[model samples]
Target: MIKNYDVIGDIHGHADALHRLLARLDYRERDGAHRHASRSVIFLGDFIDRGPEQVEVLRVVRAMAGAGTARAVMGNHEFNALGWATPDGAGGFLRSHSEKNEKQHAAFLAQIGEGSRGHHEALAWFASLPVWLDLGGLRIVHACWHAASQACLAATCLDSAGRFHGEGLRKAYRSGTPEHLAADVLLKGPEVRLPSGHSFRDKDGHTRHEARLRWWDREATTFRLAALGLEDRRSELLDDPVPAECRYEEAIPVMFGHYWLSGRPQLLSPTASCLDFSVAKGGVLTAYRWSGESVLSNDNLVWVAA
Candidate 1:
């Protein structure tokens, strides 16, 4: 077991910055893998896409995890990659290579150059990654950590080894199914539609009516307040807050990366922290040095500016 853990945030393939962050974290490169005396990294996935050095990021992360110096939970990108790679028995991919999906993965696709061996290899490896890690002291996941979704994962997605089984994969990709919702909520966080005619442009300028809710807000009274994170948007919706069932009730501290969070890294609550600092978008790549602390603190966050 890791004596000390550095929970890394979403790294959308900024290898140089990642290397710098590792150095700042005092990790040493030995035999092509980053290591520390008693510390291991818990990668919060989204390791590929949308930044320079995609392959380099993959190489570094793969080496460390392969060398037993790090552990990882699957992010939405990885989960999407698996679907994009799989065959759907109808002469098409499980997740069709549509404009939206392709655009989201353009950087990663450019590196693999489309449907090559490297692409398939990446998907296989991603399928092997667990969706979440329960470390007893804390929990780790890509996004939301609702217990209902966790149970859904157990019943229809994750196998005993924490990997996805073949049957589970079939179940998870089915639209409107419980398995699909579970995977979606876990990987993409909880999302809700805004009031009629309410819409906003995201960081990428995509028009969106659905807002990803702030799962950490236990007492949120409005949709604006319940928003998962801050983003470049038109304005707050000011609608009704998400229902009680939509909020997280887990007591275990959860550290995750997915929302492309910006600004200084900080805890949403004493037991909730977000590490993603939008490093791929010229923000900082952050990590939380979690050393058996039940109550998380803002001071423990570390980063390297991009």
Candidate 2:
């Protein structure tokens, strides 16, 4: 079990902010003779894409993991960014961002084609990351572990072989058709559904017919926590619970990234916390420390400003 650690939100290539945040958290280079303490820093993924310093973020995290100072879960964006194939391939996360990331995209393509040791090593590292981690009475993931994925989440368990499977999913993502990964899994943030013929409700409870992905509608936003016992081809909107089927029998709080939390670097959900504060967009990259079962203890958290 991970004893005392800091769970950091999505960094998104904000190297400067990340450096500052790490310094504030008391993370330092270990002297060669002295072994570092047992403390760990858990990054909630999204180490690349949508920011200027993807390479820097990758280098730092790789160093930190090697030094045993940190561990990171796989974020969808990282999966997409690292899984880029041919430039002419169908639109994947990498393709979608390539327009804005000319230099990084070119560099990534060259590295992948060269099939050098560094490329292979980086892929191996990404492939080895876990989808979720349980620490300090808290369950951590890139996003929430709703009921539908509970079985997979439980089976994968930690940062072992299970992460390879997530990597496999990434490879599949590169080849599969658009929307193949499903909107709920590929996109960050919660999920909402409007019936084929129905409308989404506003904050004032006014409903309107709008055909958009679940993440686009703010007021009508819902969480897709689990899958119903229906065929995969079935497009019926199911009333699944938000943060569904998380029994919390262990009474452990959960920490996750993937959602921007309205561009604010703060914790949401009194029970399950989301720490992605859009640091790549000039916001803050946040972290929180937890000891016991309670999540509302401000005293238990440590925030490092960007």
Q: List lDDT for all candidates, in order.
A: 0.85, 0.57
Give per-residue CA lDDT, model 2, range 230-268, as digits (tens). 224234554443331333322456777775554534444
Score residue 271 of candidate 1 by CA lDDT. Answer: 90
| lDDT comparing candidate 2 with the true structure | 0.57
Model 1: ten consecutive residues of lowest lDDT = 227-236
TM-score of each: 0.93, 0.67
Per-residue alpha-carbon lDDT of candidate 1 for residues 215-284, written as tens digits (9 for 90 to 100)? 8877665676776543344265665656777876667789888988777778888899889989988899
Provide the lDDT at 95 for model 2.
43
User: Where is model 2 more than 4 Å wrong at Cα?
Assistant: 31-38, 86-117, 153-160, 166-190, 195-250
Candidate 2 local lDDT, residue 279: 71
lDDT of residue 61 for candidate 1: 89
lDDT of 1: 0.85
